[model samples]
Target: MAGTGRAGVWAVGSAAVAVGLIVALAVRERTAAPTDARPLVVYAAASLRPAFTRIATEYEAETGQRVELRFGASEEMLTRVRLPSAVDPGDLFAPADESYVTSADKLGLVAESRPVARMRAVLLLAPGRMPPTAWGDLASRDMRVSLANEAAAIGRLTRQRLIATGLWRELEPRVRGAATVTDSANAAKLGAVDAAIVWDAVARQYPDQRTAELPELTGIEAEVRVAVLRQSARPADAERFLRFVLDPEHGLRHFRDLGFRVVE
Candidate 1:
């Protein structure tokens, strides 16, 4: 009887030890499991590349969070976010024009949006040439100009303004089409054209690039608006980044330095 009692005690002790080991192993595994640490993805317009890149770098430094930037035309960014099967959806979208945000919101892709900056069209002139004082000056026979095609946000805005002012018919014949505002600027820079119409901020990117603003091109401005996608895997983190972007001392300063007018 004594031997049987001792064996029972040992069995119970061993069982308890085995259970404890199992529990400890479970706790260890739980603690050791990897976290979801994927970098936040952002789809932004190409024109916003410079300022947004700086903003993202500052944001990453301050928060220690990674950002993946994908830059393209505003419309292209919107299309990608809208079609996840075709392209991986991004956490946020920063288009050069606010209309893209509105379209995203209509498609139920955007959770929220905020205005960042404003840009307007300007005439980028080649070196050693006089700046055109007015829109009519572009109508001169000797003046060859490059313009962004309708696909780019800047191009669409420029075309809309010219059509509204009844200058499209007169200007279209003299204009050579470029795929983007940067390309239009480059056309002028390379002397492929006498002048190119591009965003005011883009013109500032080129040092010694003479630019002339035509007062007649009123309402040709585009607002850079950022949208947080509803499908973001980390909505809270995305919102945090959005707040940082709107902070006057943070992202706004970068835009201002790049010649973009702060929206606020």
Candidate 2:
């Protein structure tokens, strides 16, 4: 009887030990699983590359997350994001301007949107060359003025707004002709055309490019929009990244240095 009782006691002890081992293993696995969030995909505007790159590097250092960038024109980026199978889409979309955001919002593709920075078109002229000091001067045959198309919303708006204000029309005959329109004003500047309309951000890039505010010019305050795409597998990470951009001091200064006017 005593031997049987001892055997029963051993059996119970063995079962308890087995159960404890099982719990221990589960706890180990739960604790050991990777919790570090890093490496997220980002699609941004080509024009925004300089300022955004600085913000990206800072983000990586503060957090372990890596930014895999896809940079291009805002229109191009918007089209890419619209594709049906863009499942597992980019973690973030930082378009050069907000028109893309309005379009993306209509498609229900953007998960989160925020206006982080603003900018407007400026008249760019070659360094050391005579620039039209006023809008009326553009009508002169000597002033070869260039401007970007409607696809660049601000570019298109700048023309109309300035004209509405009685500024652009003064130069419309000379500046609006086919010879004056270019895919991008930056291209015109690179081609060394006398003057072209371009974003303040872009204008700031070329040290040789001088910027002047054309009085009565249509000044559309384009906001640089940052959003999270719906296909993103990492929403939390995307939110974190968005916060990084909107952070008041550090990243904001980076944008300002690039000539982006941040909204209050």
Q: Model 2 Cα displacement at 10 (Å)?
A: 75
Q: In angstroms, how far off is 19's CA in candidate 2? A: 52
TM-score of 2: 0.77
* Stretches of candidate 1 exceeding 4 Å from the true structure: 1-36, 85-89
Task: Report how far residue 119 has shifted in candidate 1, in Å.
Answer: 0.9
Superposed on all Cα atoms, model 1 deviates from the true structure by an RMSD in Å of 13.4
Compared with the true structure, what per-residue lDDT tens digits does model 2 show for residues 73-184?
7888888888634444678888877888889989998998998877777777755556667766666546676766666766667767876776665666556332212344
lDDT, candidates in the order shown: 0.85, 0.74
**Local accuracy of candidate 1 as per-residue lDDT tens digits, 1-264:** 366798888888999999999999999976654245667789988878888899999998999898888898877888899876423457999987787898889999999999888788888898777898777777763689899888777788888888888888888888899987889999899898999988787888887879888886667887788999988888999999999889889989888888888887
TM-score of each: 0.80, 0.77
Cα miss at 254, model 2 (Å)? 1.4
Model 1: lDDT equals: 0.85
